[model samples]
Target: MTGPAAIRAALPHRYPMLLVDRILTVSADEIRSVKAVTLNEPWYARLGEEPSKADFAYPDFLLLESWTQTAGLLATRSEEEPADGRTMLFGSMRDVEFHRRVFPGDVLEHHVRLQRAVNDTLVFEGSSRIGDEPVLTIGTVTVAFRPREQLDPEHAGRNSAPLTGSQRGEKS
Candidate 1:
């Protein structure tokens, strides 16, 4: 990203957990991106036992969120020209597993593939890795796209929230 603000415009992330640093590649149904981790990260505050060694690390949940946002960039843009205006929701993440750690200074590349999308629902498979070694893989995610008015205000405050859980079940 030219700056954090640039990344914010590419997707609908605010404040903390907007992990993507810049977008490397994008298509109608997929996106590839990068995130540069640094010692100044919030998550590393507690994880780093040695304050002297500000060797920051990426958290699993946030990495997942990053991947979700990457897929979101694609999912949202896939229909950028559509007559209907539906917002992107993460839906349900299944089989999300972290294999390795992305430390400070490591630029992990995220590759996301769109599997399917029908009506307001979409599914995708994504993976994050450093070079040839994989760091995280999300097997499947099923989510629905609804108009912005269908969501609760509280769900926007936290990356994960109770209201989002209930709304996911209700299908907008």
Candidate 2:
């Protein structure tokens, strides 16, 4: 099992946002990880006494975030530690589906696979499950690593220009 220390070394996320708990397995093209959902999570802080079942249901977005973080770790594994002032950014998501309501006490196991890679951009496919039950399925998720300045227009300069179509492996 890969611990939080290794995750911290590869990812820039921190507490309250670092959703992945530990990696189960990793390979050149895929990774498996898990996140345990519990009432103690910050997302439940706003709930009052006698909260409804819906209140205990983990948010779909957080599930996706956790799964994507796993994908990011596998995608950048071969790189020489993440570069400074650079961050991984989601480019696109397609055909994603949430099949079940995940609640507290559920352990989400994510299986992510590297679909394709071209230069600094990567495409991934995966799914999340609670034991034998499927919870989330991702068709494709695209991500790219870019300088922080490129994401902030006010800070963007000649060196921070956005990638062009061809640069992103797209047809003109």
Best prediction by lDDT: 2
> RMSD of model 2, in Å?
5.1
Model 2: lDDT to the true structure: 0.88
Minimum summed lDDT over a 10-residue window in model 1 is located at 48-57
Candidate 1 residue-wise lDDT, 1-172, digit = tens = 2445656776767756788888887887778888777868777667645554324556677788888877877776676454244567777888888898777878889999889878778899989998899999999987677765446555455563455555678754
Compute each candidate's TM-score over C-alphas. Answer: 0.75, 0.84
Off by over 4 Å in 2: 78-85, 152-172
Runs in model 1 deviating more than 4 A are 1-6, 47-56, 80-85, 153-172
lDDT for position 110 in model 2: 99
lDDT for residue 15 in candidate 1, whole number 0-100: 55
